[model samples]
Target: MQFTIIKYEIIVVSFVALLIFLLIGIAYLTLLERKFMASIQRRRGPNVVGIFGLLQPIADGVKLIVKETILPSHSNTLVYVLAPIFTFFCSLVLWLVLPFGQGHALYDFPLGLLYILAISSLSIYGIIFSGWSSNSKYAFLGGLRSAAQMISYELSMGLVLLCVILVSGSFHLGSIIESQVYSFHSVTLFPIWIIFIVCILAETNRAPFDLPEAEAELVAGYNVEYSSLAFALFFLGEYANILFMSALSTILFLGGYLPIIELIPLPGILWFTVKCLLHALIFIWVRATFPRFRYDQLMKLGWKYLLPLSLSFLLVESSILIIINPY
Candidate 1:
């Protein structure tokens, strides 16, 4: 009984620590985006708040917290309030099964990859609820767009994941990482990696695929009615999802937590974080480089291009695995 209680205590503490770390990461990710984008555009970013604007995110958080949360009088208050919370919760919980190093995850479920796919799909409900609750035409249209976009891209993403799983022969993320000990998937599955990158970019609603929040037409989109802390919640949730996708990309292609050269010993977690950051930088770079896709263009790319490419990769990968293993 005592041992069980201690184990539960450890789990709770670990969860709290992970939550705090992720919140900090989300905050700094916004700062990094602003600074990087500003550099690309040849302008000053948040350097006024602190040394190199290191404390800018904290100031922004303070400002958002003090501002009054304005609720639309016509909005469904209950669902309006719950939507951001639900989205934020889903974004955070997906990390529970993501391994930072060997044996380092919280749950480490056998079907961790499938669990991620399932929970990520649930996040759309929050978006739909927020848009519908706002009772605004613009918000409702944005919500509908997000639903179609996510559903379209998720099929491609799932097929890409299946390709990885087939190569690894295990649904467990750790096993997938181990399967890459001799060589990374990025080499063998280069085309699939490229396709997965595009799929994840759309899945996270990042630029080129950011139709759901397009400023020109949607006018800030589904969360237009939100203000203050509520708005902040949506903002944080979006960035968190972006970082999660980056981590997923790192794990699937870059070999999670594996060092580049085994000859020089180093920590696995450090390599994992470095690879994840590189993927995050790719996301930010794409945002700076590409214009937002036309909504029809976005759908066409997902359904017409990405879906077929992913299916082809999966079939080839399965054939290769069967030939190699012959079991």
Candidate 2:
């Protein structure tokens, strides 16, 4: 039917547009991080390639693509190659369910949060595979560290998510954003929001929590053996996840697409973007500010500290909701 054909065409076009938009965002995020760090260190960063290094990310992509992909002689050829591809794929697909603004998400699922959590948890496999297939001890150890680190924070993050879901009373992401009636921060649950933000920093492996790729310790961690395009994919995937985490935090706690001031008038998408960018700045700032944690210290913080705190809050939140609503 002509209608069916039109629908299919729309789908294809939308997907292509989404892919382009996401890739461009990730590329600029790289540039943003460099420029931000440069400001902190009091130097110019990436200024030569184009106007203020606008084209630097594109040049970097092309350079990586042009370089030779060196496969380790003893590496498992299949999984080693597949690892970064898998990681990049998972990272990109997560954006599908994220609501950019009211009704503007590419795909709106009822349980979008659950979908994100499930997809994100699978990322560890890619890292583990990359490390194991490389046949390098450092890579293997780095992968192990990542696995353990992610699992630790994932527990706390899940609990954090539960608090949001409890407060919002909807699993749908758009509904959660809509529930935020006012922006700036959650009116009643600001502490939970703050905890969730911290949890996401660890979830995305930003600094203070970047043990997996601690340069001085793991020597670039699990992706060390990856060169050229493979390495580029891994790099892009990490940043993509970072942006997604920021977006998620915005949606959950910062009031997605909502203007901070009740009187302010701005397009919903612009507000959403500004909120996401602010969160992204926090991510880069944390990276610039904090020292990397000792591996044991990281585990202890996640387990002994964050996990219990999130759990206790979740329990308290649930009990309060029940008492208030009891009929």
Candidate 3:
């Protein structure tokens, strides 16, 4: 049927567009971090490649692609090669459920949030695979640290998300944004949002919590044995995850695609982007400001502090919701 052909065409086009956008976004996020850190350190980050180093990422990509991909002599070749590919794929796929703007997702299933959580949990496997396949003690140790770190923080992140889901009474991301339009639960429950965002930082293994790749301790951590294109894939995946988490934060806490003021006429996507960027900058800023947490310190924070607080808040939010709409 002509209609079916057209639908397929649309799907293909959208997929290509999304893929290109994600790659470009990841490329530039690298530049953004460099530029930001440069500013903090009172130096220029990149200024040679193309107008203010605009083409640096492109150049970097080319260099990585042209360089040799070294496989460790004793490594499990297939799994070692597949590790970064798996990491990159897992990072890119989660966008399918993420609503960029109202009705903007490639597929907006009712339980899209659950899909994201599940996929996020899967990313740890890639790290574990990379570490184990390397046959290097350093890489293996780094991967173990990252795995334990992610698992611990994920519990708290789930609790926070559960509270938001209960408050909105929907697992649909669009519905969650819509729920925010009037009540602004993110604002009313600011403390919970704070805890949620910090847990996110840990979940994503950002600074102060970046134990997985702690340079001084683990010599670049889980992907340490990777080189050239394989390493590039890990790099791309990491930045993509950062942006993805920022976008998720926007949806859950910052009112996704919603205007700061009703009177302002702006595209919802633009508002969504600005919010996402703000969340992203927090990731970068934290990296610049905080030193890495000791592994024990990090675990204690997640278990002793965040988990209990989020659980208590979840119960309180549920009780209040029940009282308000007891039908």
Name the candidate that leads on lDDT: 1
Tens-digit per-residue lDDT, 1-327, candidate 2: 999899778767887898898889999998999999999989999999999999999999999999999999999999999999999999988988888878887777999999999999998899999999999999999999989988988999899889889888889999998888854445577877777777788777789888888889789999999999999999889998998998988888888988787678889989989989998999999888888889889889889988999999999989998999975
In candidate 3 the C-alpha lDDT for residue 144 amounts to 98
| Candidate 2 segments exceeding 4 Å error | 1-5, 183-185
Using lDDT as the yardstick, the better of models 1 and 2 is 1
Error of 1 at 37 (Å): 1.2
lDDT of 1 at 144: 95
Tens digits of lDDT, candidate 3, 44-76: 999999999999999999999999889999999
Question: Ten-residue segment with the worst summed lDDT in candidate 1?
Answer: 313-322
- Return the candidate ranking by TM-score, descending: 1, 3, 2
The better-scoring model by lDDT among 2 and 3 is 3
Clash pairs (backbone) in predicted model 2: none
Q: Where in model 1 is the C-alpha error above 4 Å?
A: none
Candidate achieving the largest TM-score? 1
TM-score of every prediction relative to native: 0.98, 0.96, 0.97
